[model samples]
Target: MGVTRLVSRRRQDPGTKWARIAMAVLATVGVIDTGSITLKRWGFLGELTCPMGADGCDKVLNSSWGTLINGIPLSLVGLIAYISILLMTLMPLLPGLQENKADLSRRTWWGLFTLSTSMAAFSAVLLGLAVLKIQAFCFFCVLSASLSILLLVLSIVGGGWEDSGILAFRGVLLATVVLLGSLIWISAVDSGRSANVGEKVGVPPAVTNESSIAALALAEHLAVGGAVMYSAYWCPHCHEQKELFGKQASQQLIVVECATDGQNNQADLCRSKRLEGFPSWEINGEIDSGVKPLSILADLSGYQGSREF
Candidate 1:
């Protein structure tokens, strides 16, 4: 009777119960999302959509950040992380599980979950860059961001620290510190990826090329310097503009899509920027409607380039 009572008391630590379970559920979903992204990158999926338009999906997918070192999909890494976290959190429930449980854990679960949180946050930030800085969006990137936010919430809610002993608390506290320390690292690595690629980057350059510049002589009355294209994934006209640049050249143009429900969705962002229309352009920094030929756009901006637009 005495042994049973002691064992039950030891087993029912409050924080471990709820926090661990929540972590498993949220982390597991994150795994699935990340796993799919990895699989997609392996050429296993074969169809990556371009955030600007569907034309450049393959190009961006094949670009850098599509795979991890040694060709591992970053999504695969998320899967493994989620699976490991699930196992660690549920370990206390295993039959004779504590036999493997150390009296003072390095707090491996806490440390790992904390790491996962940081990675998720970093990924979400990069996704924003993919949209804003790069001016393109990845559907898979959105899915991953959602998963990360979900897991972070789970971790906070599942933590049973008040009921945990000093050792567990200390481990958690340390893990929190480590996660914070990594923010600078995430920011540094993520910014560059955000800056390059996508139509947003290509916009000015596309409008600046030769034939378009010559055409600008005709459109010079518009006083257009900067033109923005509001686009949607389903817009056929946007596809036409992207095609004008051919595959490689098109990706370099900066295109801002305005589809609220777009897979590369930036609902609040588009709203905040007051972006409207598919393949909409802001000529001379003033919003203009419809897809204009490259030459016409150049005239609006007074472009001077030797290359044929």
Candidate 2:
């Protein structure tokens, strides 16, 4: 009876159960963090209310450094990582998968260690980019990095390793491969949008008249609603926002140039409004930061225009 009880206990160790729970919780937080960023970047969600300044968040997220593989947002990759971690951590907890739990424990722990360490390594690279390359303070990025570190610590502590040296060696080797693989992937697939040291911000391609009528009408509605576009002449995003309006319609916008020497400059007013990010839209005294689509602008201004953008 004691031996049977011991075998039953080994089948579902209470300690490992707790560890998986902790990891799943952290991974879920990571998912929300990266998932929100991905949605916002894709324009499906409005701008994030970053705890750090909205301008700082926008600058970092929209910067060339944010792209990883062929214009894919780095947040998307992070989203995948977090989801994978969540799924893997939960796998052994399912009733059906519990049959070989003890047998899989060692391998599972090492596998998790490898994944967590890889994430930590990638997070380290991102932290460096946020500090050195982006030179922007992003609260979300920092939070994700903190989560990665915490997850790594949890993995190491929960692994229940028999040999410290073996664990360390495996961790180092796995981390190195992940880091190098990421570097190679980035180099081979980079979109060539790296912020050039002295290059002028390229103008957005002009919008053709073939653009939907709703988009053109939305621009007019924004103007009629006393909407203002606070922008900088050197801001690529500002140009892109203008291009969305097409030529004739864009002419109707009350565009305020925040650059001191820019045409129709309103640098003082922009400063007074505390404008930091380019292409910010102001409607009914509410400022929406970042490049927003015509549909969003229309909805914000309560325009009953056609939905097509």
Candidate 3:
């Protein structure tokens, strides 16, 4: 008799129906946002122009702090998480999967709570990195974090739990452990990657002499064609671009130092070019930005040489 009454009560819980609807809506938005970022990062889509300005999106995207979990873009992980949340949100509504037993329904609630809580914790850590470490505003990152928080709230209030306090305690414990573990793992990976980049950045231009003569001629042509590579000495990306040219080709290229402390500093010139990012290039009076490949540079400079770099 008691079991039947408990099942009847669970059936009439309004929170279950409303929470399902809310989770579906939130998860859909999350899917679109994270998917767009993932596609862009993977080069399936074009570059994103941040609404906040040029210094906003790319800066955060290119930063060492943004590289999470084995150098994978954080957006990919978010995409998977959002998809999982969406699947879980829809599962309880399926006729065959709906839990008729009261205890099973409680387990489902706990599972949802755990997922949402862990996501929220991770989002909080990302928020901290954005503000304190990266120090840049990213619309996509903020949107993902916001969605995670909303899902967490819905999971808690919409769960319709009789003992909310106990559930809250367990959720907090799970979230804390997940957040700390993630931080430790990410930090270890980041340290190794940073060391590798440091070594690459420190390599002398002489080490790049192995580049072919054709590459040197292309670099010279780019300079004579009124092309300029705007760079800051302190920018790792600028060092990366220079490394691509090697010493001989890089010397022939028209490289402008935009950093105030750099040799032959051209801060005013860079500002006039509206340079807000590192490794911007001016090809025949047209400005193109970011760390461009040598092939693209050859095409832009109209190099008809051997094409061997």
Candidate 4:
């Protein structure tokens, strides 16, 4: 009777229900945050009105670190993580799980702790990259990191664990593993550091992709229409924009090197134009920033030869 009563009392102890509620709310916001970025990257949505300006967001998001090995947007990974956290937070509250609520709650709390720890660790890695390597301020990235840290904190405060030592051990182990894995993945995909070593100091990477006939025609048409691409040698998005045109087509386009140290630089003209971001396009005497799809560029340049690009 004593043992049974002890078990019952322990089970009935009121956990921090408020913390779970807060976690759910935060996770929902995270879902929307990451989801919007994913949609924009996939071209399902138009340009995002980032706080401060679009330049930082564009630089960070179009960098080589922005996508996974398979070319999927990194924001999609955050979206999936947020959705999983949301489901875990709300699952034990369902009416069907009421009979096993105590046990389910215990297990889910552990799951939340592990998952949130991994997220927070990985977020730290990304933050380091944004600060030290990418050297850009990404509002969405900062928001996601904040959310992950908060989720980890909530998991700890609300778990009501009996063994602090065990919790500490698990957290340390998981974080170390996550940090190591994140570093390895980042090093593998960082083209700025690895692939451009032999090139001149201020030269951009060579365009490796082949141009389609449609792409070639579009490029010629853009050149004939007096379209100009303004870019800095260090800008990843500029390289990305060139890659879209492929090697042959990219050579045909009028590319002005805006960086003072870049080869064949036109710094004075770029300053005269008051350029705000890399890879800005001057089409029909109108300046626009960010990387444009080939089809959009074709339209902007009044290219009638090829809609296939």
Top candidate, metric lDDT:
4
The lDDT for every candidate, in the order shown, is: 0.53, 0.74, 0.74, 0.84
Model 1 residue 217 distance off true place after TM-score fit, in angstroms: 40
RMSD for each of the candidates = 12.2, 7.2, 5.2, 4.9
Q: What TM-score would each prediction reach against the true structure?
A: 0.46, 0.67, 0.75, 0.79
Best by TM-score: 4
Model 3 per-residue lDDT at 180 = 94
> Which residue pairs come into collision in candidate 2?
none
Off by over 4 Å in 1: 1-15, 46-63, 69-72, 99-109, 163-200, 203-309
CA shift of 167, model 2, Å: 1.8
Instruction: Write the number of the candidate with greater TM-score, choosing between 1 and 4.
Output: 4
Per-residue lDDT of candidate 2, residues 1-309 (tens digit)? 343111112335566678778988999999999999998777688657888566557656766567655658889988998898888778777789767767666566656777789989888876776677556678998888888888888777776655677677878898888778767654543334343223343233344454467777887788888999998654657767877877777878888877654566777898688764678889999987888888788878999968877
TM-score of 4: 0.79
In angstroms, the error of model 2 at 179 is 3.3
Candidate 3 per-residue lDDT, tens place, 92-183, comes to 67788745545555666666678888888998887787788656688878888899999999887777766656776788899889899878
Report the CA-based lDDT of candidate 2 relative to the real structure: 0.74
lDDT by residue for model 4 (99-156), tens: 9888888788888898999999999999999989767788999999999999999998
RMSD of 4: 4.9
